[model samples]
Structure formats: structure tokens, C-alpha cells
Target: MVGLLGWLISFFVLIALLVLVVYQLMCLADLEFDHINPYDSATRINQVIIPEYVTQGGLFLIFFLTGHWLLALLCVPYLYYNIKTYMDNRHFVDVTEIFNNLNWEKKKRLFKIGYLVATLFLSLFWLIWSSVEDDELGF
Candidate 1:
């Protein structure tokens, strides 16, 4: 059982994660950040922005707080996806026509698929871990 202090901390972290998600949504909608210089192609804000890190990290924290170690292991694959997405977007400015024409929509779909796979893996691992733990305890 998590203490009151832990619950409060988790709640605050969840709120912060929600705020970041909203900010990312605003960026995606192109309804803000009009002041950024278009000529400065070097600083691609979108390329540096991978919002899943926050969401997935928040979920991992929640799982850890709930003592779901096996489920929390999903963070590994989530981090991998985040790094891959960032790298794909960062080098997207390459002069090669192939790199320049990278499809962001497809990348997003792939990330979503990765997240889903991680979720499935987490569920399966958690189930097996719990069953093994139960057997060890003579359940």
C-alpha cells in the first residue's frame, strides 16, 4: 500500500504528464509557436519533440507505485521506441531524397504499434510473474 505522500507525488506527476500531452497536441495542431523563425531549419522543434516519453514514463511510475514490476518493465521497449522516433526525425533533414521524404504519419503509426506491443508484453509478463509468485507462496 502506497502511503499518502506517495499518492500525492504520483498525482502531481500525472498532472504534469497531462499538461505535456496537451502542449504536444497544441504543437501538432499548429495553433501556437508562430514566433519561431522558419528560416532556422537547424532547430526543428518537431524533430526534438517525442511526447510518448512523458506518457509512457508516467505509466511506468504508476505501475511501479502499484508494485507492478513486471508491467513496469514495459518502459524498456517504450524508451526504445522513443529513441528510434527521435533519431528518425532528427536525421530527417538529410539531403538524400529518401530521407527528406520520410513519412511522419507512417512513423507515428509504427510508434503506436510499438506501444501496443509493449502493452501486450507487459500484460503477459505480469500474468506469468504473478502466477509464479503465487505458486512460490503456495497459493
Candidate 2:
């Protein structure tokens, strides 16, 4: 029973982390396009949101449902890359970068921090999960 509870907790936490990553991707795509093309900001922003949401949702959902060690193996590097990029680019901001500069700055800052933390936690969890015993769950 305790082991079952632990598995449930881990599963929910993974789902939350997946959702958080999706949110971060939305923000990243939004900021990138807004930086590249300032004129079509509204249209560009609107265009990317739905697709980003859908793509991340579907991808993470597949990963969660499959719940295979091989799938987790594939995601580790990607999560590490995101963590590295988030840390590397957290400070620098171009003058044209509107997301972190202007209104809702605090919110954007929090999201960036949260994204990095989530990625780190997710990667660490994967490492531990892989190294630990398979147990009965085969998670």
C-alpha cells in the first residue's frame, strides 16, 4: 500500500511537471516570436499559443501514458537542455524583448524560475527512478 501511494504521488507530480513544461514552452515561443517580429505581435502571439499548448500537451501525455524507461531515457537530455538554456539566458535581455521588460514582469520572472526548477526536478527524478529498483510497478 505504501509503495502504491508512492507511485501515485510520483505519477501526479510528473503530470504537474509536464504541464509546467508546456506552459514554459508557450512562454518561450511567445517571447521568441515577439522578439523577432514586433509588428505582428498580436497575430503571432495568438497563432503560437494554441499550437504550442496542443503539441506539448500531446507529447507529454504520450510520455506519461507510455511510462516506459526508454521514454524517460529519451526525455532526460531534452530536459537538461531546457534547464541549461533557461539558466544561460535568464539574465540577458534585448531591448526588444517585451516579455521580461514591460508589464507583468514579475509574473514572467516567476514563470521562468518555476520552469527551471521544474526541469531540474524532473531530470533528477528521472535519474533516481532509473537507478532505483524496478520493483513490481515496472515504472
Candidate 3:
């Protein structure tokens, strides 16, 4: 029971962290595009941004499965670096141009609402799966 509880706690924490990482990435994408071309039909943000989060999420899942708490913990720094790089790249353009192009209110609202819902669903799944006793059932 203790082992199961520990696993559940760890899984929930990892899910929360993964959701945060993904949400940060999405916000970064919004920031990146807001200045250059709000209407630009580029799927690069979705393609590149989402897959990176998925990969990290998969890594966390694997680490959780293997009970490698230290390895899973390292993802926090990795996620930070990913977002930092994305932000640093945004500085090359003129500040005035970027500011003029941005719709800050809309971007903020969209990111907050979308990310909140996504994180909620993801955390719920993690919580559910973590609570299940391995010996009790098959799913």
C-alpha cells in the first residue's frame, strides 16, 4: 500500500510537471508568432512545440514506470532550458514592431484557458492510472 501510494504521488507530480512544460511551450509559440505574423499560416509551432512536449512526457512515463525518481526530476531543468531558448530567439526582432503586432490580451486569455483544461485532463488521467492496483485488474 505504501509503495502504491508513493507511486501515485510521484505520478501525479510528474503529470503536473509535464502539463506545465507543455503549457509553457505553447505560450512560447504564441509569443514567437504574435510579433512576426499573427495570421501567418505556419504549423511549425504546433508541430515542433507539441512533439517536444510529447517526447518529454513519454520520457517521464518511462521513468515513472522504472521508478527512476532522480531521472524524472531532471526534466524540470530541461523544460526550463527549452523555454528559455525559445524566448531568447524572440529578441532579434525590433521591440516596437513586435509590440505593435501583438494582441497581448487575446494571447493571454487563449493560452490560459487552453492550457488549464489540457492540464486538468492530463492530471486526471495520471491520477486515475496511478491509483489502480496492478494486481487487482487489467485495463
**Model 1 lDDT per residue over 1-139, tens place:** 2333343444454454445444433343342244333323222434434454666566677768776575567566765766676667752333233223335533553555555554645454545566666678775
Error of 1 at 36 (Å): 8.1
Model 3 per-residue lDDT tens digits across residues 1-139:
5445655555565555545445544544666665434333133333445455455556556555666575556555555544674667641223345435445533643654464455446545644665575446542
Model 3 misplacement above 4 A: 35-139
Q: lDDT, candidate 1, residue 37?
A: 30
Of the pair 1 and 3, which is ahead by TM-score? Answer: 1
Q: After superposition, how far is residue 99 of candidate 1 from its true place, in Å?
A: 14
- True-structure RMSD for candidate 1: 8.6
On the 0 to 100 scale, the lDDT of residue 134 in model 2 is 50
Give lDDT tens digits, candidate 2, residues 1-139: 4434444455555555555545445554565556444435434444543443444344444455656445445555545544464467643234456555545543553564565366446645754565465554555
Provide the RMSD of all predictions against the true structure, rounded to 1 decimal.
Answer: 8.6, 11.9, 10.5
Q: What is the TM-score of each candidate against the true structure?
A: 0.40, 0.34, 0.32
Lowest summed lDDT over 10 consecutive residues: which window, candidate 3? 38-47
Deviating ranges (above 4 Å) for candidate 1:
31-66, 86-139
When 1 and 2 are scored with lDDT, the better candidate is 1
The TM-score of candidate 2 is 0.34
